[model samples]
Target chain A: MRRPQFSALRERLLRAGVAPRAVRRTIAELEDHFDDVRRELEAGGLDPKDARSQAYARMGSEEAIVASTLARPELMSWARRWPAVAFALLPAPAFAASFVGSIAVIACLGHLAHSWLGVGLGRSPGLQLFSRCFALWILWALPTAAAAVCTYAAWRRRISLLWPAVGIVLVGVLGSLTNFGVQWGTATSRTAISAGIGISTGHLLPPLVRAASTVGLALLIYAGCWLASRRAEEAGSEG
Target chain B: MGDAKALLMSGVPELLILRLLAEREMYGYELARAVRAVTREAISLGEGVLYPALHSLELSGLLRARRRQVGGRTRVYYNVTAKGRRRLEYLTSHWRRIATAVEAALAGPQHA
Candidate 1:
């Protein structure tokens, strides 16, 4: 229909927060359906130009499609429906979950290694190995992951970054409060793993200090990404 | 009057789509053809109404869509889910009741 302006339709649907997959499928199907309809019309003895015009008419107006899609609540994303939850409220929780989940994985791996490889994780070399991984996760991976998730959620939803920025800071501060320690156990205990929450309780600096630094690092990374994207967009427009 | 017609027409595309897919899995073009055939072109839904309704149904867990290669073309086929079947049954009964009531009304006091 009028060449469908399928790209424009795609942009409109995405701008209106229809899921990308649905939008892509819809546009593709519409293009294909138009071709079929035009072919059928031509077969029915209409002129090629008439068939083209009629095919467009049979596809319905673009506004109608957009409106109908908008009316379906389920087609809109969760982030679109609740920007606050997806961008703001979920970051700290997501950080907490990442920290806990990573710790669990490390612990599980230790257990599996001990069981399968006859290595006592409580001993020197084995304990040292898992503990290094644990420290890396707590200090670097978990915090970075949380910040990345928050940034990505905002970017993907095409929502404002104000809440996600707040979310990143909150996650950083809250994530720093947890103290995780792994050490060789006493005679009765195996490899001892401990978790507690307090201000600067672990090997890290004070709570406020670590939070500020972590947030600073995360923001730096995010800023670099934003700058790169902006430059790319500018370059694209220029070309 | 336009609003009323639109309101009445709501759920109609979903019902027809679900009912058709409930019988056989079909891609978008094939399904549209089937709808035209079954309704004798009386209820021809253009891409606007049809695709949106299909997507809504899929998102609501009422329909399942799959992609398959057919004669070198990748066609997406849709089938009604268990949830869609229940939804179809409900819509069918509801439509029949409305049709009966409208018929009775159209037939006037004697029929009532």
Candidate 2:
């Protein structure tokens, strides 16, 4: 008896916006039920091959199961069911979370290094590099990554592109607010890190440029992913 | 006749599921067997098709599912939630009303 391959069905369910857990459980339950039917038929004097065939009949076609599952709109993933809330309305709070989360992650890593390796907390070249990279991550890479994820998810699920674009722009603006600077301390003072969010009217141009660049980067990533997927599909058809 | 029976079987899986689960918790295979037993093999739905019903019911919060390991095998048990009981009540009443109306219509034509 050949094991049932449900990879195609898994992809279909995912693209249809069924929750990941629901899709997995459905596939698992189907496979398990098939096995039980096969066992039962085998116990009733059928050969293994015949049992397998009977089990397939008894279990019904995957197409039937897929159709039934997809028919229930309530089974769809929450994010897919409400694209605006998941992709647009939530990005603001998510941006704040990412900002604070980034800081927390950096602080945790620094603390680990300090405790584990006896490294001093501040005034080292390592600290400077860490702070700079973290600032860049929060201000640019994080937002780009977030937007790129939303774009990819939407593209994968064949969702409308509007929410993802809005998410990109909103996340980009938030990223621009990740203001950071090196606070130079005098002879009796220590080197300090100054990080604040927001830009004054006098210095708005840089933040605006930062936000625009973040959006550009996210768009570039989306285009690259889209092109790659298209090429793969074309190659598959050709082959 | 077979095609008519098939057509009428729409949503029957859900009804049977909720009705049976309202009595006791059962896994998919157990529920499938119980369905056959209760219907005396009259409603022979492909056993595998029950899962979509079960899953959707659970997803919609009409049923609660929990996984248990028995003899090195995992089985998911499902029970009707309070909401499920209420839904079952509504469905049962609705189904009875439809059945009664159809029965009367079929019988009235014969009497005429």
Docking class of 2: medium
DockQ for all models = 0.63, 0.61
lDDT per residue, candidate 1, A91-150, as tens digits? 888778777887787667655655565534466685677687778679666776787777
Cα lDDT of model 2 by residue, A81-181, tens digit: 88898888777677778777776666566555555655344556766786777777777777777777777766665566688789888888888877755
Best-matching candidate per DockQ: 1
The lDDT values for all models are: 0.76, 0.77
Which lDDT tens digits does candidate 1 get at residues B55-104?
A: 88887899999989988878879999999999999999999999999998
The candidate 1 chain A region of ten consecutive residues with least summed lDDT is A1-10
Candidate 1: regions farther than 4 A off: A1-7, A17-57, A114-134, A177-189, A194-239, B39-44, B59-61, B82-90, B100-112
Q: What share of the true interface contacts does each candidate keep?
A: 0.68, 0.82
Error of 2 at A92 (Å): 6.6
